[model samples]
Target: WVRGTRNGDMRDSPEESPEEQDRDEGSSPSDAKPDVTWLGTPISELGRMPDCGQQLPRLKNVSGQHTVLIRTDLLQNGKVPVPYPAKFTDTWDDVHVKMPWSGMNLFPVINEVMVLEPDAAEHLFGSLLPDMVQLALRASELCTKPIPLLKGGMNHSITMSQEQVASLLANAFFCSFPRRNSRKTEYLNYPDINFFRLFEGASPKKIEKLKTLMCYFKSVTEQRPTGLVTFTRKSLDRPPNWKSSQSQLTKLHITCEGTIEDDGYGMLQVDFANQFVGGGVIGSGLVQEEIRFLINPELIVSRLFTEALGHKECLIITGTQQYSSYTGYAQSYKWGGSHQDSTPRDGWQRKCTEIVAIDALQFRSFLEQFHPARINRELNKAYCGFARPGERSQNLSAVATGNWGCGVFGGDTRLKALLQMLAAAEAGRDVAYFTFGDSQLMTDVHNMHAFLTARNISVGEVYDLLGQYYSSVCKSCLSRRPDVSLYSFIYQQVSSSLAPDASDN
Candidate 1:
């Protein structure tokens, strides 16, 4: 998938290699007019604004050749012929080909250097497109059908069959839902899955992302899996006194290496999500959760109907399959290749793995995060995500997470770690923290955990200490040791309280 085709594939057939096929057809290796036309109009002008509820235009190729235009930058010595239309000549832009369906006016963005597979294209539009369109229409009708909201520490989980997921995704594929694609502050809270941004002002990076997405669609449509999946939104009421608890703190393992997905199988994986749900899937922002969604494209479908997660809310998704492998981070990311998910299904035919999406506050100023109210909000958010409905400690698995909001969100790693630990302890669950290559954080967290453990400090004690530390910092009492780390401050506070008379001895 990512590398294109293998040597022994159909591309190597006697008719012509895929690249040569592009050249021999309407696409010219040298600057020459393309043999195809749209009702005598130039290919560039074929992009007309679509009407209401109109289907996307049909794609056509000259000489009955089914070809896909791939961007040149992604290939070696790849270039769209100079004499082609201005849209095709631009090196910085994705190749924009007008669809053939009359009155249907959507342009499918493709690279300038590749050709399409007729069989693949036929299967994609012929078999999949109609059903996808119908599904989208049906979903639109149900948008206002009044599903119950998860509120006030309530626990709710909905099971969506594979067919239902495909339907939800179909709406996203067609960009059918309204109130998306707007950057206005009000709409910022919602996830946008429409390809409008990708279609307009397309970039090489965006084009690659689009390719990975298309490959995912191809795989799912070809072989519809019979498994069902579940999405659970959990909310929890804050305990009045987390400090007075006598319960021992849940198990804790902190490391500066590894990731939630790779090392923490069978554990609940944490998705450091944007409030908008899918994060930057439609854009170029690739962070922790975004990267996870790309590898497991099925997870992207959640954005279809998932509203922005609130402060007291968290989403738990089960049974989404990982369909692709990727490398790099953020802008440098690339789809490595196709992946076949082999994770076994449970009695419900759902994958046993579970993922929790919890959005962290995007603090503008570091100090804003330390306020008591802000801290409480984060605590509730994490606790909501960690709490398993009706499950006790014996059945609850440990949590797997990393420097969740530390990257783009500009969060304090130590503070975030402590918050997570407090929540996990409250829910009677353990934590496996990955620092994601941050050695300093790993060491510091390990030392802090050790110090707290040696003194048998409960999570409630840590919570009380955090309040005292925050007050000291706020009152400028700790300005004398301004460089002191959060962990050190907490450690000193806990030690003094635990062995107050040891200093005199």
Candidate 2:
């Protein structure tokens, strides 16, 4: 019995009858606004749109309104016979697409004006067309009924089937959500899951990300695995005294290579995400967690219901299947190939893995991160993600994470590492920290942990010592030592705090 199985399947439970589904499907296309259009055309009508003309041919829906436009000859059996413009093709010298014998192909059917170079179209939609259409239809049908929204701050989990994930993604693919396009302050609270943003600014890197996403959709729709996934949010009323506890630290592994997904399988992996949930999934921001979302696209659907994460709130997702393989990081990213996830499932027919998304604070100034309020916020956030659900009796697995806020967020790596250890200690979980090629961080963290372990210091004591250390460091710029690192500062503070007075002796 999995932790969240008591409620039965939360997705596509067949509870809704035909009449209920029809009523919830909303009105016909005629009733929809003129601007509303389908995402792409059916596979049977692939390549119907004229190519290389004065103006691109646009597909119109039944209501005689403009829809998506696609070009078929651009791609055939994964071969890009038509070359792309120099700008877009510069990075494709070594690129190759290995098409499966029989799979679907999808064309970009967008309401907005998009002029595609023949090469770009072939690279994006060459081998994954028909599967995309099926996913789109399934998504639209699921969206007919409102997704049941769970109240935030509740310590419970929701499990979704693979079919449910496809449906949710289809809705995102077509941009069918009513009020998500706007970035206005009023809509800031909602997650942006639509792919329209990615289509706006076309670039080599952006197209590569789009290609990666398309491959993910193809795998999930075609494979249709019977596994299930779960999302759980955990919140705590009070912070735990991590330093004072005598509990041994969970198994710790430090590395400078490998990623969370590839190296940390069967463990509770961490997604260093943005507060808005689906960081840049629908857009072009490809970093740590965004890259993860691209590979395991099923994770994208959580944005539909997930609100902006609070400092004390974190989401733990279990059983999401990885669909694609990617190469490179950030701007240098490229889609490698399709991946067949063979991870074994648990008793409830779900992959026996977990991923926790806990956002680290984005500090404007490096020194601003040391503020007690900010520190406490990060501590709570990490703890929320690491904490196990109260309903489960089993022990929690260790966490796999690295460089949480060091990249785009400009966080101090040493300080962030200490914070993660503290939070993991509080929750009684060990950590597998990947430095991602930062050897200095690996060495520093190893030394710091060794020192702390030798002293048998508890997390509560470390928390107190951090307050004093930061205070001293903040007193005056001239008085503060320029060369002191966070690890050295803590080591010095703890050593002195435990030192005996000569007079008392």
Where does candidate 1 have its weakest 10-residue lDDT segment?
A: 7-16
Please provide, for model 1 over 1-505, each residue's C-alpha lDDT reduced to its tens digit, 9 standing for 90 to 100.
5453211000001111111121100101123323321111121221111111123123222221222122112221112111112231212111111111112323332121113455775685555554444444443232221223223244555554554465456555665433455647234544666656555555665666766676666665676556656666665555435657555566667654345675665678888787766676666555456667766666776664466777887888887776676654444556666776666555445566788988888766666677778888888888888876566566666787766666445568888887888888787777787665455566676677767777788777887777776777744633333355677788777766766585587
Question: lDDT by residue for model 2 over 1-505, one digit each (tens)?
Answer: 0011010000000111121121100011122233312111121221111110123132122121111111223422222122112111111111111011102212233322233355655685663454565555543333222233323555545555566667567657766554456767334575676678878866676787777777766666656655556666566667665445555444457765556676666767888877776677667566666667777887887776666677788877777887777765555566777776777665434566677887777666767777677788888888888876452213455666776776446577788888888888777676777665556566778778877877888777777767766677754444433366667788888888789988897
Model 2 RMSD in Å is: 20.2
TM-score, prediction 2: 0.71
Number of clashing residue pairs in every model?
A: 12, 14
Clashes of 1: 12
Question: What value does the lDDT take at residue 217 in candidate 2?
Answer: 66
